[model samples]
Target: MALDSLVSNFFWSNSDGSGKIHWAAWKNYRNLKTREVGTGHYIDVFKDPWVPAAKQFRIPVNNDISVNQDMVVADLVQERSWNLQPINRKIDKLYLDLISKIPLTSSPRADKLMWAPARDGTYSVKAGYRAKTSAIEGRTGVTRASPSKKVDTRIWRRCASNPVCPVCGDETESLEHLFLLCNWVKVAWFGYSMGIYISPRNIKNLGFWLEEFQLLNDSDFDYSKAYVASMLWAIWKLRCRMTFEQVEPSPSEAMEMTNRAMKEYWEVNSLFPKAPTFAEPEASYKWRKLQSHTLKLNCDDAFCKKNGKGGIGIVCRDSEGLFIKGWAEQVSAYSAFHTEMLAICKAVQLVEEWGMQSVIIEMDCQDLYKAVTQCSFRHCPWSLHGLLIEITDPVQNRSLVSFSLIPREGNSTADRLAALA
Candidate 1:
């Protein structure tokens, strides 16, 4: 069947036009000339998109044509060969050449429809949309170029009232300045680059800078591209925030936002299997036997910044190292440290509810360890002050309860559970 006919039939049969919005959308999308024919059995030879030179094969208007409206390209083929005598006499040489070059099989099959812009002869919505956009851009004399150039053109044309950088409040806002040269953007890029251990090169051209990273021989080259793209997007968003909302994010906050955005992009776009979480060497940290008659609780927290939520896992084991009871819960939190503090607090509440006289709480966060050991909120961020108070209360009320820090490898089970939760 012809692709358009198939689509039209599907929509017409499935839809009731009670709401005209959906029907209008379907009709608009169906009208887009995005499909080409293969084998040419189902498509109209003169009316449908069958020839490559033009969207449809054009018939000479001055010449008297005797073909039926229902006729297809197959009617022009006989005995597994093109009946080119009549076609050559009717159409121009360019289209005739396109039709003549089409390969024919001894055993013919039904014609198929394929996306014209796709390499694999398969359909892709993205490719079709891009082709449509390119056509529109071509007609307007606007070509795909660097965003900086587009912005500069707009500024020159006085399309924008002000062209200054919103984040830095200095320098004309071009793509280069927004992404790399502005002081605020520079700080964000520096922090992201340092965290990933990839030094920023002193390249000014945005295209060359991006291309250089993409051409690197390192295994993380794609990840590097994602990081750069994320930073660029974050910088744009920061500019928008400043311009529209009149709010500025700190450099650290901007970097964090960029990292979280990159993580989300990877999760949605990744095709490879997820890499295993790295663990410290087993020899570096081993689980120790709990003191006699005391229960040991291993707690861990997994925070997903995209959702502003976290998972907590707490597993209690007897002094002999056998599992007693385990619990996992989801909680709201702003940061990893906050989640860790909440997990510790949950562990304490569980211990107190069980009426365990002597219990040891172990976790994998060194910051949380220091906060508890120092008995001071100096090391804790202000966001965790209230949770820290709640956490310390349970510890102080129970004379035998204590907090300890263990390496992540030693807390593998709890970590796995937290991830699952």
Candidate 2:
């Protein structure tokens, strides 16, 4: 309201290049603001983005017909309902269903401008910049998704210096050629993008490419769209680096980058997300005895970052530190800490198998220790529920059972056994 009081809907008007610093941002605001139709007065039906989910939030215009900028949404209404006559006469039937579905009123309540991207109709500079960064339906051969559109300077780059494809150096680098038809881009889509096997058609239109590309993700895991977007972004960056900077574009680089990002994303969102870093106690490393009757089970796990395989090792000993039983096995695991939890689970199985009482399980994972011992996992992520429940259920059932953290040096024997697995 204060901004409106200052400039009187500056968001809707073009501030001419009068050396204003906010000109680029000022231009982006009009495109993203939608209209919430109450009275529909002052809401330009042809220009405003009022139709929900319509392409660019506006109805598809017939290029043959000249558009009147003065045409407001009120012009299409008759008796609290959308009159199809004026709409069909003007914008055509492309978004007639979407238009009719919109909630309107016959009363004189003023139309409200809304920031379309946000759930709540408010705007911040961060949201404004985000909207601007994603506005690429390929008006230019550039995208903000690239590494720092700032590019060692604040000078605004509209397009690359060369129109030719920097990677192939054969054809003009349009958005279609760069993303869909580029030889390098094709390799990335097939190799890095979950082996998307859509055969290349000689399609020049990106819209047609998107329509066909939707079929690439048919798996139970719904990560295809984000994965595909990441691939496209990587390819865009590769081309940008090659064109703007002196860096050579590598097809493998783009594919690998996309693959790495998607892999990390999958890890985070998957059942076994990456664990937070935990600090160990700052004391000299030594195994401690609780009681003479208590059987100390030292558990540790080894995870190969190179491969996804994990090794669980558990060693049971008397209070005197003499090993009574040792067990090791290889299995699939999600993270290093994940394997730690698995090791504890296996130790619990050993406890039940051996049918022992007065047991203490020790592990090298401090975070897991704190999470299991101090925190109730009921409110934690479901990713940890299955494993935490497995380890903690026995603890609840058995009064003598407990868990504690040990230093890496104190857990060296179990570590060795795990490595052998």
lDDT (Cα atoms) of all candidates against the true structure: 0.69, 0.71
Which lDDT tens digits does candidate 1 get at residues 1-421?
A: 6999877676555544231113223343343333333345777766676554354334333246565567677777888767877556666775665565344444455565544454433546565556556655877887676787667656643743678765667777665666677776677777775453323356456676677667773577777777777777777777677767888856787898887988798888776777898987456675577779999999998999776668999999999889999999987665687778878988888987988889889998887888886766666753344456667765776689998888888898898888888
The ten-residue window of minimal lDDT in model 2 covers: 148-157
Model 2: CA > 4 A from native:
1-283, 378-381
253, model 1: CA deviation in Å?
44
**How many Å off is the CA of 153 in candidate 2?**
8.2
Residue 135 lDDT, candidate 2, scale 0-100: 63
What tens digits encode model 2's per-residue C-alpha lDDT throughout 147-227? 432342223223656677777888876666778677777776777636664454656456656655676445633576777
Lowest lDDT block of 10, candidate 1 = 17-26
